[model samples]
Target: MPELPEVEITRLGLMPLINHKVSQVVIRNSSLRWPVNLALNSILKDMPLVGLQRRGKYIFASFPIGTLIIHLGMSGRLCIASKKSAVQKHDHVDIIFNGPENKILRYRDPRRFGSITWTEDDPYQHKLIMSLGPEPLDNEFSADYLYEKLRNKSVCIKNAIMNSHVVVGVGNIYASESLFQARVQPHRPAHKISKDEIKSIVDAIKDVIENAINKGGSTLNDFFDVDGKSGYFQNEHHVYARKGMPCYLCDHPILQITLGQRSSFYCKNCQK
Candidate 1:
């Protein structure tokens, strides 16, 4: 699944090419998506893309009349291709802009879990986004706020951060990396963590997320940029997927365990 950094990069890459350009929307398939693509034909064609933005992992393309919300599920990607190019398998949505330059943007999702939704107003109010917590890079998410949110929570630290209500876009890979950086054990109960440890975790989360974004996000299996290039962040990972490997900080053998049914990797000697 694409995380916040990958989504942010997509939004930035899309803003310049999409905004102010009139797009000819084409939906080859909508039966697999939720909220359907019925109203897309009415509002998308001939409408200038007012803005490109992101909320959590969902990408939003704003128009005068409505907005297009895109979710890249487990195996999904948004690519920019020639308007005249032929459609490939899993190319479900295409928005072609016939203006000063002919540019085409396509959405490909092998899992079909991705979605395309149209909303008349703010897409943030969509049921999928309404309950999501603040973006980890935003001012709304801070050490103090995270400490408050984690107070008295008995759930494991791994599951707490995975909760959308607690934070957004801290996926399994990020969660493991952040906890390792903070020296907090992933299996530690949230309530048992001290305020200082919570603060460290919060700071580690932000730092790790920002670094990942700068590195173009971690490519777990099928994620790619708008140009279909692979991201290199996975190569720089410190704890994630490094089970039995030596810890970079202490030379201790990195350990891995199942937490919340997800693989959690850390140095037992380094992380408390």
Candidate 2:
């Protein structure tokens, strides 16, 4: 799935389209997680794109009359392409813009899990985004907040942090990497973890997530930036996916375990 970092990278890649007028929306397939609303064609025709921003894993394209909200579900990729560019098998939707330099904003997903939904309603108040937890990179996700949220939970701390209500965008890959970095055992009960460890975990989550975004996110099984490039951050992995490899800090074999049905990698010795 495209996490927040990957989504943010896509938003950045589409920035060039801002301030341009929508020429039209072409939908090759409307059977995404949510159907591409047929009404958007009439609503967004020639609407000036005013801004673009990301909240959690969704990208918002702001316009005078409404906003287009996109979610790149498990295997989705959003790219900026030339209007004349050859469309491929999975090129599902295009928000074609009318400007000499701007490109066609395309959404593609082999799994059809991604969505391109529009709202004349306020984008921030949309049902999908209204109840989301704070962005992990912001002060709203401070250690104090994380520490308090986990105070009475008995679930594994890994599952707790991965909850979007607790803090958005800490997905499976990042949850493992952050817990490993913070030296917290993934299976440890959330309420039983120490305050200090909780603080460390909070910081680790921010660091791990920000580092991935700065590096353009991890690309495993089929993530790519708008430019058709796979990410290099996989080289930065310390424990994630290194099941039997030597630990980065303790030299103990990195171990892999299943938590919440997701593969979690950590050092048995380095992470307690």
Q: Which ranges of candidate 2 are over 4 A from the true structure?
A: 217-227, 230-232
Using lDDT as the measure, the top candidate is: 2
TM-score of each: 0.92, 0.94
lDDT values of the candidates? 0.80, 0.83
| Colliding residue pairs in candidate 1 | none
168-253: candidate 1 lDDT, tens digit per residue = 98999999999999999899999889889988988999999998887663342234334455333565788999999999999998
Report the lDDT tens digits of candidate 2 across residue range 12-91: 76766778888888889999999899877778888888999899988898999888898888878887778667888998
Name the 10 consecutive residues with the lowest summed lDDT in model 2: 217-226
Residue-level lDDT for 64 in candidate 2: 92
Q: Where in model 1 is the C-alpha error above 4 Å?
A: 217-227, 230-232
